[model samples]
Target chain A: MARKQGSHSDITGPRVRDAALRLIARHGYAAVSMRQIASEVGIQAGALYNYTPDKQTLLFDLMRGHMADLLAALEAADLQGDSLSRLEGFTRFHIRFHLPRPDQVFVSYMELRNLSDENFAAVEAMRRTYEDALESILRAGEAEGVFAVPDPRITTMALIAMLTGISNWYRAGGRLESDKIEAIYWDMVRRAVTA
Target chain B: MARKQGSHSDITGPRVRDAALRLIARHGYAAVSMRQIASEVGIQAGALYNYTPDKQTLLFDLMRGHMADLLAALEAADLQGDSLSRLEGFTRFHIRFHLPRPDQVFVSYMELRNLSDENFAAVEAMRRTYEDALESILRAGEAEGVFAVPDPRITTMALIAMLTGISNWYRAGGRLESDKIEAIYWDMVRRAVTA
Candidate 1:
């Protein structure tokens, strides 16, 4: 009986998160209810408590999960070569990583205001770590004389915003393929920072 | 009686819009309700119908007003000088214009999915026109051999994304002043496309 219950949780947990993400992405976190999320997941509303304590916790978990996933993926990318090559690698990886997860990207930015202050600070710390990765690359580039960034911190924010903004308009079968888009962006990014 | 009614509307109209923008920006359009907006405006819920037919229309009107205002302001900006200088003018204008209206900027992007099909198309057309203004500058620069933009349209999107992103983190008394921020961004923009 215990094994069966554990197996049920394994399937239900992911389904709960998936439903919550879709609902919250379509409607704001404040508008979506646990009942609706449970309905979407084909579970009883009471059963949701088994997976999450409350809506805020669920929101925090989704956001925390996204940031953790981002950091993990970036670490696994194992960026190599000089700063120039690493910058290119980072640029392409950002586009590729974010393009497939539009809902996560949308919710991550849009629902940030809904997070509790402590949750916000926690999420922000993770985000800063990600930004610092790129800043380190820029600092290295500046030292190597391959780049001439005036302000690495501001430049990091600008470049991330530029790259993430792609999720707003990009479609799979659109006018330009993702590779083409990546190449164009990489060229612009390269030119923007290079001496 | 007619004069009194007109005067009342003149006051109420803006209050309603201001309330809607704040609520919708904070909670998102889908999450916000007509009753809440009416409360925010210090009016009866039923009276909201007298001003706008429905929540969707209210959302549409706010979005339309924002775009219209943006276009009119751009037109009145009357940017002069060469393409490079005009680009500088645009960069500064965009940052300054959007910084104070973070709510409008937030709603404009976040609530696009909530807009009706026709409303979405209408907003997109206005947005395209704005993009065209920047594209024209890039084209002129390329034609004059001053810029090396391989794709003017993509470059226009990238530049706008980078500029508008200032709204995300900018504050009134932050570390850097707006003017300093503008100059730094302008330098990056100039380097990005110059030959």
Candidate 2:
């Protein structure tokens, strides 16, 4: 499964990143230290340097990986047609992508404070790329006369916000299954867009 | 403007809370300290205690007051309507309430970890109350056959998520005016459920 990046380090890197995610999610990123992340990973603070060069790098790696993974997942999903259909696909893909690994989502949202100025701008650019993708779909739908919206850009942000909110409240043992949760969001997304 | 419930201590309490919020919003809550807040307030850290008992109290107080203020604002808007009107009122009210105080919104979202168990529960309860109110409006709309939603609870959450995301990105000098922002959201919310 490993490429130029060794499976050993790739796998171990995520492990450390996961620990940092949970720590930063539970305690704000500003309060976390490299020593604390190292302790969480069952290694000496000095050992963490093997996986990541420094604290900011670790945070950047996690966020960049997360944004990349999300966009890749969206691209991988074979979704097309009207605005409503694309939105349904998005809702389903988003729930599947985010709900399973909530700590990662929480980390990505809250740990932006840890990124250096240059890194933050880069990640934010990626984040906007995803939003623009959604808007592109909505705009196409409007052009095709399949969906009607006063403002496609605002709708895109609204839809994302609505979909991601699922992570804040969804629980593994909850009454609804993940697929069911996806379906629920898809229903709203479709309704929100249908002409 | 201060009420009788306000004392010298009470007068300073809000100043101390505001300083804490600005710092916590700029830096995460865990990284912020009572002494920092005192310094920002231009008062001694010891005087800061006289306003708030401790750091935890200050965090919780800011969050709780935020939630309380949010609910009160919604209640006060009292904008009359059928289900759609009520929801629009909520959308407008939420945007207006959040615009003036981005830092409070930031703290409410980012500082939940700092809240003590009792404090967290209280804020959580109030949040649910606001959510439940919205959910009930959806239910009423469903009953009246004026709105269509697959799940009232999920729809409620989706709307709240979309509304809150505004605070994350909206800027004072942005191309979109605040009223335009509100109208854009209102269009989405209106189309999302109206039958």
The prediction achieving the highest TM-score against the true structure is 1
Per-residue alpha-carbon lDDT of candidate 2 for residues B38-60, written as tens digits (9 for 90 to 100): 99989987878778778888788
- Report chain A TM-scores, every model: 0.96, 0.90
lDDT of 1 by residue, A72-170 (tens): 999999999999999999999999999999999999999999999999999999999999999999999999999999898889989998899888888
Off by over 4 Å in 2: A1-11, A81-84, B1-11
Error at A165, model 1, angstroms: 0.5
lDDT of 1 by residue, B1-195 (tens): 778766978889999999999999988887789999999999999998889999999999999999999999999999999998898989888888888898999999999989999999999999999999999999999999999999898888889888888888888899999889998888888888998
Model 2: per-residue Cα lDDT at residue B180: 96
What does fnat come to for each candidate?
0.63, 0.83
Per-model B-chain TM-score: 0.96, 0.92
Per-residue accuracy of model 2 over A1-195 as CA lDDT, tens digit each: 337567667777878988988887888777889999999888888889999898788889889999999888888897887666776676777778888888787778777766899999999999999889889888988888878877887788888888888888888998888878777677667767867
